[model samples]
Target: MWAQAKSGPLPHPITAAGTAPVHDPVPGELYFWPTTDVLAVYYADLGQAVPDPGLIRLGAIDTGLDDLAHAGRRVTVRIDIEGVQ
Candidate 1:
């Protein structure tokens, strides 16, 4: 699943540069495109390749992918940090 900003890029505090941008991402992988401020979560391999500069690796989903795929096309998502308050 991927979401792009309709108006413009959203404000963020990420200062880290892209170290390992991937051309082909696998399932359960997470990525953030800095240029477009788009966030994506791979539930399955779409057989698509990312453009140049590629996508910044965020992390991976260890579980609940099946639930995600079954949640239909649109769903609200909430991200919770472990210790950041």
Candidate 2:
């Protein structure tokens, strides 16, 4: 769990590109995103064959009410996704 949401899409994608993700928080309504199709459908682990974004599920994260704080606002968090190379 990472953020809180009231409704709608998560403020950010789930397990985004990274070998070491800094999980700093978790919420009750939290959920690993980009797992289901409606969110994301594809993902890859670098050298691994790139799955179709429509069929791949590389990661998920937590988002909920915490995100709604800046509702209608723009927030930016950086995740480092990379190639196997």
Candidate 3:
């Protein structure tokens, strides 16, 4: 999407929406594929190293460092917590 938007390249279903199609960012598009799907969505990098899509496709991960920028960084996460009965 980012590449296409920047390059004017397009996908199979180009439409009035332009090269980049629109969709809600959360569960709508996030889970559009199985974790193993051969697709990705990218965003701005906050001074981080450029990520290798191959590494991401293979589930390679980064080790978080206790840096000044991340000193108080924390996230509360929940997943699949409902309808388990």
TM-score of model number 3: 0.17
TM-scores vs. true structure, each candidate: 0.71, 0.21, 0.17
- What is the lDDT, from 0 to 100, of the residue 68 in candidate 1? 69
Off by over 4 Å in 1: 1-13, 16-18, 82-85
Candidate 1: C-alpha RMSD after superposition: 4.4
Pairs with backbone N, CA or C atoms under 3 Å apart (clashes), candidate 1: none
Strongest candidate by lDDT:
1
* Candidate 1 vs candidate 2, lDDT winner: 1
RMSD of each: 4.4, 12.6, 13.8
What lDDT would each prediction earn against the true structure? 0.64, 0.32, 0.24
Per-residue lDDT tens digits for candidate 3, residues 1-68, read 33211111112321222222223222111111222232332222333332222212111112221231
- Of the pair 2 and 3, which is ahead by lDDT? 2
| Candidate 1 lDDT by residue in tens digits, 1-85 | 3421111233464643738778788777667776778677777776778788887777777777777666765665555445567
**Candidate 2 segments exceeding 4 Å error:** 1-55, 63-70, 80-85
lDDT of 2 at 57: 32
- Candidate 2 lDDT by residue in tens digits, 1-85: 1123222344555454443322222222222334441232111122232233312233343343334445443544433335545
